[model samples]
Target chain A: MFVIKCPYCGERDQTEFSCHGESHIARPENPNEVNDKEWGEYLFFRSNPKGIHYERWTHDHGCRQWFNVKRHTVTDKIIQTYTMGESKPEDNNV
Target chain B: MKYSLLNLVRNSFSYHENWQEAWSSPELKKEYDIIIVGGGGHGLGTAYYLAKEFGLKNIAVLEKGWIGGGNTGRNTTIIRSNYLWDESAALYNHAVNLWEGLSSELNYNVMFSQRGLFHLAHTVHDMQEITRRGYSNHLNGIDAEILDKEQVLKKIPYINGDGRYPIMGALLQRRGGTARHDAVAWGYARAAENLGVDIIQNCEVKGINITNGTVTGLETTRGSVKAKKVGLVPAGHSSVLANMAGFHLPINSVPLQALVSEPIKPILDCVIMSNAVHVYVSQSDKGEIVVGAGSDAYNSYSQRGSFDMIEHIMGPLVELFPIFSRLKMLRQWGGIVDVTPDRSPIIGKTPVENLFINCGWGTGGFKATPGSAHTFAETVATGEPSKMAAPFSIDRHYSGALVDEAAAAAVAH
Candidate 1:
């Protein structure tokens, strides 16, 4: 079992948080502005990187807040856990 | 050497000293007609069928590690075709048909057993869902029967019928069962080797070389090998390979964990799955109780899951089978499963020409081994999706036409 250092609540068991899938995927600015292909890509496509990955997590039991986690998929190493609106870290070394 | 009773006796005469290697370890060739990446069961099976059925010689299967060391060996080894959709029924049933003859066809005993699969229902909704799936399976000409609690109890006497979630009814598929997962990989490897297919171990595909939207070759850890066609059968790492090809698959990789109890006297003969409980149990021929759990909450290429996930699954497992409460877990491990949004596989050509992909089986790929290989071999050979594989093309995602199997898959896979 791994521990996720929640941005709101410092270092919590992974069970206290629920993965919200790939992060930084913003909704379409205008619903009808894009074609079906673009809309689908925005809705479904994901990087799913085997190395470093950026994903969202919700601390369901701890602080009950959402945040972004830059993690290494292969290593299960959490490089950084930042607030949801923050940008990806420049040096995502994990 | 063909595994026959006569050969067994002939080998016994010399203390079994003349036994030949099941498959040969060959040096990677500079060029092959077709190259299959990820030397798991599906890759090995694809190579076998490609050479035997498609008549393509000078083929090689590249594996990063030894064969069957991936999900092929990590799965619970349950095989079933009782699906809710016609496409899935057709595809998986095709595998069942091929599985019926896999042993003889590969000249090796895969130890396929036809013990029925019982999907237990703990609630009325589960019963309704099972009934719907049963009818859908029957409409697709797949074997399925709805069994009440009495039948379920009769089939499995050790289960707690009156647990917290009382057993209601089940969907029974008599053709569904389990097989020796490793033997399957070995059998296919041997048969493919005999058919002039090179089985290259420790050769990982680092990059896919495509020239002008068509296939050229692969850059491997060993060296670059040229090929006109490349079929990717990588399970959880499909997206990683797709990235190397300059494409993105709508696939997420997660760790699906499984555990086995210490060997004991044979008690459970049939496979039992409970979607409500999120656990499936089956006894191996060697008398170990194999239990499968759902995927971990997060995406992970690391084949380790959170310990609480195991703790959560074991609660329901023991609640159903109280006798196993004291049984010690011999080993626990996980396999990375590449799950798609529709819970269906993508088989056929990709955006890059001549780069065929047969992946996204998710947690239920073992049962589809033969059918996957059979159709993939055809697709790669003819540069078209086979009749059975047409519905699973990647274009369906864009067209918004999917053979959704979410309800059928549930948590069992």
Candidate 2:
């Protein structure tokens, strides 16, 4: 277990936060036009990479806000954290 | 050398020094009819069956590490077939049937102890869920029996019946039990190698060579190897491999941790699993209590879990079995499990031609090793999923025909 710098609540234990996997998947604007495969891809397919993953986390116990975390999947190290509306960081050196 | 009494007696004359190696580390071949990625039990078993049953020739199994060094050796080794769905029941029960004769067929002592497995219920909802699953298992010709509190206590008197989250009842699958996890891998490897299937270790697949959306070969750490029909069985890194082939699997690789307590006199004779309490424990033949905990909240490939997970299970473990309160944990390790949305495995052809994928067993792939390899060999050989594996094809995610076994998974995700 590690500490998470929650964008809204500052630093907190990882237990206080909940990870909602793979952030920034936009829903189709015209859902009625998308085919079954496209809809399924949106619903199920994930880019579960071995390294350099951008994901969502919610501070369930502390500030109760959602944010994005750019972490290394293999090392479990958090490189950066930003609020939900903010764009992904350009420099992902880790 | 076939392992037998005569062989044992013959080896004893040489002070057990002249016994041959179980399997050979052959040089990588340039091409083969089939190439199985990953040297775990599932992959090795797939190669074995492809050669033995399907009469396939020139098959190879590539391993990034030593054989059975991945999740195959890391699982808790709890084997059971009492599933809630008909599809899973059929699939898992096929493994159970093969497991019954695996030791004899492979000429190896896998030590499969069918000491019974009990799924305890602590709450009303758990009771209902297990009752439904037990009936479903019976209807599917698999064995299951629901026992009330008295019957549960009568069988396992050591369990605390009046503790916090008291045990109300349990669903017992007498045929379910543990096996020697490493032996299962070694046995399959040796048997597969004896059938002329090449077992190559320290061979990592660096890239998938796909031409015109069909798998042609793989570039490996050792060298490039050609195989038109390739079966991908890399368990936790499945999505990584899929990405190499211009596709993605609906999989999330997460760490699942298990620990064993210091060896003591045998107290727990059977496996006791409580999904409600989130603790499963079984005593090894060497007398250490093997305990399993739930997965961590976040995804990880670190092969280690949070300390809170230990505290989480220890609290309920002591509540259920006060005897284990003082036993020190000997060692703890984690395995990266490839979890799916519906908690069922994906065993079928991939989008890339001649590329078969057998993965997404999530937290319980070890139990389905033999059955998965058996059916997957057919899928790889004929480019079509066997009847037993058809329901678990990749198309299920699109058609929404999921086998949904999250409840019966025995671990609360």
Candidate 3:
């Protein structure tokens, strides 16, 4: 079992957390203005990058707070764990 | 000699040393009518159908590793067509039909056993969902029966019918069962090879050479090879291969792990799946209790899962089968599954011309091998998606017309 460093709860067991899939996929500002294709892309498409992935994880069992995690999808290495509003760190140079 | 009793006896007369290789290792040709990347079950099956059904002889299947060395061999080989959606139900039902005759059609023993499959209901909601899907299956002309708690107990005597997640009922698909995973690939490879299809192993595709939005050739580890058409059946590597051709797929490659217990007497004769509790178990022909669970929460291509995942799944399994608490797990392995948002597959032409892809099978591709290949071959052959494969086009994502099977397929896959 790996540990997830929740921005609020510090390091905790993975069971305490729940993944929220790929991150940085903001909702469209105005749904009425968006076309069906754009709306679908917003709703469905994801980077799902093999290397570095920016995802959201909620410390549901612990702090009940959600945060962002920049982890490598292939290596499972957490490059950084930041708050929900913080921009993704540029440390995944590989 | 053919794999028959006469050949067996003939080989026995010579100390059983006259056996021929099931398939040939042919030299890669400079160019082919079609080049199928990834020599897994789907790729080999596509090649087999292309040559056998479509009458396409100049075909080559390129594998980065040996055939069936990927998800094809790693899956827990459960076959069922009791999907929730009509499109999926129809597609999987077609696959099940093909599987029933695959052994005879291929002239190879694939060990297709219809031992039945059960999806146990752990909650009232689960039972309701089962009832709903059973009705859907019925409308699709698929065989599905809702069994009460007593029937589940009768079918699986060892299961703790009254555990924390008590068994309320189950959805039984009597025609669904298991097949020897590797044999599916080998049978297709051998049959495809017999039809003059090249099975080139250890040939990794490095780059896709496309000109004017049309696929021209592929640069491989062996060398550059040209093809008029290309089919990508690379499973978890679908996104990676698509990236080479300047396209991105909404596919995530996640590691799905499964384990097998040591050989023992057949405790379970049929497949038992608990989607609510997240565990699937079936006894192999060799008596090993095969257990599989949901894919790891995170994405990974390492072909391995965390110990926490195994622990999480084993708890529900052991709770259901108290006798298996002591059964030692002999082996554990993982496969990278390419999951799509809809949890269904994408089988049609891509933005690139002369390039077709059949992937996004996610956690359940092995069961759909034959039908996937049969339709994929037609799609590649005619440069148009067949009636069976038309609904699974890539444009579905944009059109918001999705075959959503995510919840139903979650743990059961």
Top candidate when judged by DockQ against the true structure: 2
- Residue-level lDDT of model 1, residues A1-94, one tens digit each, is 7799998889988888899899888899997998877777776678888888889999999879999998888889889999988987864465
Across B28-78, the per-residue lDDT of candidate 3 in tens digits comes to: 889999999999988999999899888988999999999999999999999
DockQ of all candidates, in order?
A: 0.76, 0.82, 0.63
Ranking by TM-score: 2, 1, 3
How does the DockQ of candidate 1 come out? 0.76
* TM-score of each predicted structure versus truth: 0.98, 0.98, 0.97
Model 1, residue B203: C-alpha shift (Å) = 0.2
Q: What residue pairs are clashing in model 2?
A: none
Q: Poorest 10 consecutive residues of model 2 chain B by lDDT?
A: B404-413
Off by over 4 Å in 2: B407-413
What is candidate 1's CAPRI-style docking category based on DockQ? medium
- Candidate 1 has which clashing residue pairs, if any? none
- Of the two candidates 1 and 2, the one with more favorable DockQ, higher being better, is 2
Residue B278 Cα positional deviation in candidate 2, in Å, after optimal superposition: 0.8
